[model samples]
Target: MAGGSFALPKPRPSGPPYFSRNQVANVLHQVAVLLELQGANVFRVRSYQNASRLLGSLSEDLGELVASGEIFNMKGIGKGLGSALTQAITEGRWPDDWIDLHTNTPPGLIEMLGIPGLGPKRIKLMADELGVDSVASLKEAALNNQIAPMKGFGAKSQQRMLDGIELLSRFRARRRLDIGLRYGEAFQRKIAAIDGVHRATLAGSARRRKDTIGDLDVVVAVDEADHETVANAILNLSGIADVKGAGDSKISLILDTTIFDESFTVGHIDPNVLDAIGGDDYEQLEAGGTIDAQVRLVPPHVEPFTLAYFTGSKEHNIAVRQRAIDRGLRLNEFGLIPETKAGDLKGMEAAVHSLGAADEAAIYAHLGLAYVPPELREDMGEVLAAETGSLPSLIETSHIKGSLHNHTTLSDGEASLELMADTARKMGWNWLGIADHSPTLKIANGASAEDLLEQGRTIQQYNAEWAEQGVDFRLFHGVESDILEGGKLDHPDDVLAELDYVVASVHAMTKWRGRDEHDNTEELLKVIDHPATTVLGHPTGRILQGREGYEVDLYAVLEHMAEHNEEGRLKAIELNASPYRLDLDWRLCKHAKGLGVPVAINPDAHSIRGLSDIAYGVMTARKGWIEPNDTLNALSGADLAKRLVR
Candidate 1:
């Protein structure tokens, strides 16, 4: 849990595969745990533990460090440990002892180590005293009241283990959108390189950009003659660890996440999660995450139809199929043909060939509809909108000018203000906003009012320097002020009034969610009416796959925001773009658009890398029918600053 996710080296065609610094470091960390569990010498265990942390913190390339022999010169790593790290990186082979330790350890004990606050020592104690080997056995022990009497585990601790097991089960059921996309896109790329693959596109919920995905779907186009060759090649891809089934037309695979490159973000998938689900489940859920994938091979002629069928929200497909039926035509993955009698198969094939639908757009043209973007394929009136030629041009990533809710190291962010600003300039953005946490949220090292004011002066100084250089960029100062119980903003109006904006968010859900829905709605309404409140952050307080949003009357809240905007108060709802919390749920974004209440696609970023998360927000915006004109951040800095003025 100390280092980033441990990933197996992806297979390389020409040279030994490369391993990320974190991957190497995590391997050491796992070895340390194994050493301790095996009762190795205290100094020996400490060596691995110290080296793992050291390697994780190093920015240098692991292979280069090992090759130049600089790793041995480092403080904690001696020759023996350094040699193990070297072999893993240069030869793409984990140290023999590490593999042997894994083989000998009961996989159940490894999983038990994943429980929060349960370390290797605690796990060893459990196995020795109660003979608990797996999560199921641990759960059984806890349930049977056998764990409570243990010296270190009381009733409270036993209860927590049960709860942690439940949470782990839920995490394994599906993967977050970010994780799914990383694997799906990587798999599609590999498939496209196969000898005869004409085209490869991701389908299913992944194509629709859903917040969580159960399995990935990919549709490949190939000549009929190449189906067998292509399918065989796909099964042998490096990441395709397990084949569920294989055929000329379809292949089911379990993609190993360990083989994915470090470019894929794995920080969101906690290391504790990987540690707890060991063995086969551990392989299935690679430390970064693993997923089941299906590849469908179709002839080039039927590719369009197959893509559409697979890239479906079931309801959307059903509605379109019904339309075809009403027109005395049949729409299937193969093609659109006349709805003829069963005995007229030859005529049906002829009719399909004669239609000459070349692509998904052409297929839609045959149905008298405009092209519906895959994101809009949900059956939420998209069919009717397309038929009427009334779909709005959805927001694109380029439309964003700047975000008004981001953080710096002054609060909980990983980058400094200067670094964040420099990154934004390189990104070709006109402005960036710093809305570090207010003092009430101590967990984030929330900036105090004095700290906030000082930061404002720092921002002013940056603006002055930019102007002196004739640069067009600007920085707005603000706070992600907590919406306290009963709807009070964290800072007083006097403090809030000095800043450019305020993002009022409900962080302590226990207080707000404890009330009735009406009361919860009223609390948010109070924030909306606050003269200093500029935007509402993560409106639903929902984290995809982690938990459901708190119950509140979002309709009433959106209406209040709309009413305030109509009164010229200029309220905006933030579509928090952190992949984990694409809140303001796309389902409600359209309603906000209709209410004429501007939506702000704020990344709510905690680091400079996090700034790119806005792309995910833009996708969700497009899915919700949001356009450039409907968002606050789409405005240039000058326009946005003017609008933020009360």
Candidate 2:
């Protein structure tokens, strides 16, 4: 059972409310829709849509006003809509037509809208053209040539579509940090081999630790004379499916191969053959010629830089450019240039044109701003930090002392507690917490009251034995309790009190959509404030691509945690490190840290294979700018136990 902390506000008065004018309008609109769908007058349907739009724009909650029995006093609510509103508010059911329309819409079609290039219209067309209604079907159709013959889709477009689908399929839904790192290393090695190249680094999403990538971007510096050689060298690299375009300064490849895909012929190519191919020959080979390749050099100063800049998230780079513009400067991937240079900035966005000095710091100086690291270039708080020279020394992997949330055979986990403890010791951890699931989660073999007690005794025995043997590591008794409907924990207060530490979570209440049903965020806050609850586990309840977690206002939850901490709440937020569910998204870590909320970077490991995921968690923590002191696992075992007790 997943257990986590949450606090609930005092319950408001229950029962149905009188419909307000706005509520009446909304209900009337729904009635109109139902009426039209059932072959009612067209005018009535139009009225419903219009009224719905109007009601949605209203400032106050119509249901609240209706509950107060004050909605009848508002204008524009005739008897028809008023009746519908009252019924809906009291019973929580939509009118018939609205329900039917929702039912008729294919759920698969709705999911297709989220893919990058596919829109609603395109999805409908694909459904009509190739009978593809789901992502899986659409991908199969694209790969199998069902999409190429469609109007407006040529070979190139089909390839792009297929590439997009394949990219999405190959990587785990959220993309892993390691994929980006691996590609970065590959790019670095390729660029470093160029005779005149001084430096080559990857920036953008990869630097930000995004798990998947659309394309790889590499920035390189070379002597003006060697620019063409570097560009040619890059274009000549093996495994490039297509050269999107090549210019003197930069080269772009639509990667036809991946580190994981071995079926591609290049994977088996001899190193000697790879070395022997000239840039032109390589380009020809990449263009689908014979193995012998040739390449050419072009001027490198401008194009490579532009390509690098363009490859990043345009929104992120645009914000940076705007900052430079504000200071009478222009910034691009190459460097910062003066705004009055009397040249078009369009093509040269990535080229470092006019900065007086080399490196990012010098470019920032030119713009009268301090340098920002590539990793923190997302424009969140990095810009301000640069100006203040108060950038955080974000926690890195080495700062972590141990993992606080792990599983063993006592639950559904693959490894036993003793094995996990031994592994933790080998990893040089000063402490480890074994937090198996509580009993309510039968699928995971969650522990019963007796099981938990036995586990605790075993942990205590192991701790003593290890201490006697000078093993130096300590194991703590912990359990992950499930949060049930109505925001209640699986275990009672007495059972919870027996554990050395409790990590509360929501494993079952994922389907509760109505905020009124359970204030999930508030409930989590309450659990955090619970005397026995020490950590909130996987706060979002997301499983990466598998499922989006229960709806909770993350910012609100973080703020509440921060506020409670000031009141001496000992609750800590979890950064679960199950690669697929790196909950507590790194993007929000900095904000949590800013509030002085301690974050527990837990592996959430279920087995020995899962244990290695701690590295990913540590990377995520670093990305969030978490400091060692701000992380719960950074504490020594005794210290961690004491902290939990508090």
Candidate 3:
């Protein structure tokens, strides 16, 4: 009306633009890589690396630190880096020098950095010595017998380069769950707040909580009279990079992530996550990334049907459509209509009246079935279970009372023990476990037996003090002990017995990956049979899109855990909650539940912010039909204490 036509509300300018902590850290990390590739001073490169690590580990708001100029006071951040960070954080732009370095670097060299086993040093060597800059050129060199003759690289190493290049191609196809949610939820919020939109909800594989997502889908409900206005408003939203298509019912867009408002919580991303999805790709996602999104607009009368149809696994939709056909009805995204001889019922008027459904649940009820949740809509016995009223009471984030697998600065983790405990307490957890890396995992800076015991005493002191103050908080000390050759754990039984529990994980990937599935399964069975082993951590060692994980028959491994658990020994399988490794794959979680083996939803966190990754794990658990009773995270501190005393 003010402009002679309806207009969407403009977002208020919030002074100077500020970047998320993640964005600043990522730019700094990129600068370090670029400098290293250019053979810049080693100390200069190390400064950026240290700054990146420090900023990443910080729980404080980076914008506030920059505003107050307090970041300059931190150790290792000199005036030069501090000014650069200030400009990057407060101005929403990288410094010109850093940009120049990035610009001069070949895009192919950056891509090669992600090709596992290839670091900045080796990549520089290839570019200079063999004229190989990209994966394509590197592959050509390897195929032509040029790489084997190079110094420090033999035939075996040449083959690995070939293998890694193939893996890199697959990583480009889909973004991980966390990255997809960042863009999807951001766009959904923007559209939902528009003037003519009634309600907006995320749909598609993202809504179903799939671990990897291709494109995003958002459904919006609007009155018939407001369709044009709402569609215009969405296309005009600030983050839209391009309008792929616009129609009365559907609008497609390519969203730019870099332009989103500060209201979106761009949380800390683990380095492993960055590596799992290629670093160059993740950097693009953080700095100037674009994702494809479709916004579906439907009238309020058919909103329920539209939402349900769009939030689907195709197989689940087919099953429900078949169910509708069997009952003399035709169900589609518009509405459920009766199978009349005259097909005039295709219009919304006939269908809404015929179905008399107002929501997704009501639609299910009308079909003589209970409502199936979005996560369970994968066509894996859910239709029959809903019909029989036997669907599980799936686990939620609130059901998690504590976690048995976490880390601290004592090992590779970024957060110290005290900070980790405080963060857990703030999350309203009654207990928190510290399972730092054990002695043999040297790469992780594994804690020696002495150091671990010393940390246990500190935890004992904290537990005693909390008890004295009636805080109802406790801490458990554990170690993520490595499972070595022949199934022997990294730490001796004598040392392990001194801890509250033990998390046995495989860090020796080379040896484990060399074995066949049967052998790998047997190795896992031996770890389960160990008297001190409390949980199996990240059972598959898979890094989502990055690695295929070691070959192991997880079903056989779960069976072994089940057998051990039934014998009155406490054994559980960890659903490692890192977005990069939701291992104990969701597909296998139900089998673990069926076998009566408890699932431990471990964050395997390395920082204060990482504790919240449990939310992703909960989504995975619910997808696998796991209930609260089937997971160790749902157990109370006191109850879990008793359960762990094997």
lDDT of each: 0.80, 0.63, 0.82
Off by over 4 Å in 1: 1-171, 262-265, 268-288, 341-354
Candidate 1 lDDT over residue span 54-88, tens digit each: 77645455667888888889988888988877787
Q: Cα lDDT for residue 347, model 1? A: 29
| Pick by lDDT: 2 or 3, better one | 3
Cα error, candidate 1, residue 158 (Å): 34
| Model 2 ranges off by over 4 Å | 1-198, 211-213, 222-243, 256-316, 340-353, 469-471, 492-494, 513-518
Tell me the lDDT of candidate 3: 0.82
Cα distance off (Å), candidate 3, residue 34: 39
Candidate 3: worst-modelled 10 consecutive residues by lDDT: 1-10
Query: Which candidate wins on lDDT?
Result: 3
TM-score of every candidate: 0.71, 0.66, 0.72
lDDT score, residue 609, model 1?
A: 83
